[model samples]
Target: MIDNNFKNEKAPRNLGLYIHIPFCRTKCLYCDFCSFVSRDEQQREAYVGALLREIEARGTKDYSVDTVYFGGGTPSLLSAEQIGRILGEIKESFNVSPDAEITLECNPMTVSDGDKYFKELRALGVNRLSLGVQSAVDGELKLIGRRHSFEDAKATFLAARGAGFENISVDLMLGIPSQTLDSLRASANQVIKLAADHISIYSLQLEEGTPLYRMRERYSLADDDTAADMYELVVKMMKDAGYRHYEISNFARGGRESKHNCKYWRLDEYLGLGLAAHSDFGGKRLENTRDMERYLGGEWLEAASDISNSEREFEFLMLGFRTADGISKSEFLARFGVGFDEKYGEKMEKFKKMGYFCEKGDALALTESGFEVSNAILTEILDFDY
Candidate 1:
């Protein structure tokens, strides 16, 4: 039996639901997502129970959720019945819109079950699948410790299509230890050939705690010069394939951007449930503890994801500037109730002179070169005496 929780509510928000599935088959060397290697039936069932109760507890808010995202250790690991039940819970709890974009992140290794599980997931309301297909080259995939092969990824993509997922996204990685520009290009070209609806290309981030980080002490990663060249190749290839480089790392065909992710990039409020999930209910950012004992037994006060307005402003700038569309002055004003130009005028004056910032109507967007130096640009925005 699950205990009912007192829901926290705030002013109307650009609300979204982020359900974390914290289990994986084998943790990738580069993986740092909050996941544990487990296949315990009891634990899986327990998590679903807690998640359902939490969903029920938050049912009081009369807000619209434009998206629901299942991210994690590999959300595809869960049985379709578990996922379906939670969707039922969400529908029973909140005023979820009929046309909301619901997404599930899946790893290629799991889709070969031949059980027609994805169809069941679609029946339960998951309309999009973000497939983890980091590389097509066997050496790079082996270096990164992915469980699935390139062949498996292709089969999974076909399976997802067979299962009725029209809006599919593939995750691609560059700068792996065993990768060269040509090798990585082969992966990107393969993804394009698959005709995936969306592509998210991420430069490998070597975090200190992962196995890949330890291996990095010995392995020479593809050089920064090479990585830049790889990115350039990807831009050309993906554009030729008819995908729009909407954000720094994301590309989509037509208008198939990840609506759930937009909620995050646009600094909209979201509720994150499950161990190590993060949330920003209006301006107060929170993160659930990574420890299962603390998260499950104690009052789940996830670490703070957002705090003061100063932090919020800096974060907003950091997130908003990552997109080619950039942050809109009007949207910023609508959220903060202050004109962006009024707040960031002199600051923009400098960046404008630097060929980084440009004006489109009342909005400020970044140029292609500006994206390469976006972090430093964020520093310039943050240095403002706000």
Candidate 2:
């Protein structure tokens, strides 16, 4: 069952740059990401200036950047000129590859005049757009405190197309309050019809302190079992619609997978810039201070943690399991100086017998059922000490 093609080694020395824009029109009820209400034009301009200074001070020209992602509170909240200025700084400060995949995440409400925004973004070298289209059902969206209507989402997608964004991704939400299997399927179908190159279907999570968590007692949301059913149905439907399930929550058309995100799952190095952004580069994990005022004052405070070999191996296995590609046995041995089966052969046999895993070539991947309980399996199987 061994495959000779899969080798264990770090990929070529390249960089993936992630720029966080912590400004948005409004914070969604479920968002826990570091983004605040849209600031005044003066405040916004000052923030962009600070970001540019940070990029210049910290960005290195040594590594060739192959991917750049502008993620947000709502990156689209920034005018195209502002976004373009940041891109210019990155390009000047780093050895950005010519064909780099530059993506910007946008909320539908911010893109009512998408044609104008999209064209400017394209001119700024951003080739991909990731639209936040949480739900196709209007009622569900309103309950979630989303500002855009379903029709608005459709219009924004069309606008992106008309403005020349051939590589676009759409986000969908499942298991939200009052979200049924039918509604989830309808949303998935709508996105599929949009022919977005990539699709990300995330299950609504009830994190404490969010508005949804406070309102949980009032709304009867889908139970775990119902959510599981919705997950299965969407998986089958997305496959039928010709999208490959590349990652747990992400799907893409052929060759359209997110290159920047793949680096994260593969345990490759990436650098994140901006307030509260995290980075794993040069063998340490670093997190920027979340305080915007402190950041603006030129105090780029950060927390740094060095990763040991054991921690790296643990991450390699855990992250790889989240993708269609299961970890390679030979690669594990090469990297860790221990064979996969030699260390965990019995555990592998046990899970295989339990039908949670399937052996293909040198890789042992989770069955569809296994993905539902991956946390439990990983906890039991991976020895953090080793």
Q: Mark the 10 consecutive residues where model 1 has the least summed lDDT.
A: 1-10
lDDT digits (tens) for residues 250-271 of candidate 1:
9999799999898778777788
User: Which candidate gets the maximum lDDT versus the true structure?
Assistant: 2
lDDT of each: 0.82, 0.86
For model 2, the stretches where C-alpha displacement exceeds 4 angstroms are 1-11, 383-386
lDDT of the structure predicted as candidate 1: 0.82
Question: Candidate 1 has which clashing residue pairs, if any?
Answer: 285-305, 285-306, 286-305, 287-302, 287-303, 288-302
RMSD of each: 5.2, 3.4
Candidate 2 TM-score versus the reference: 0.94
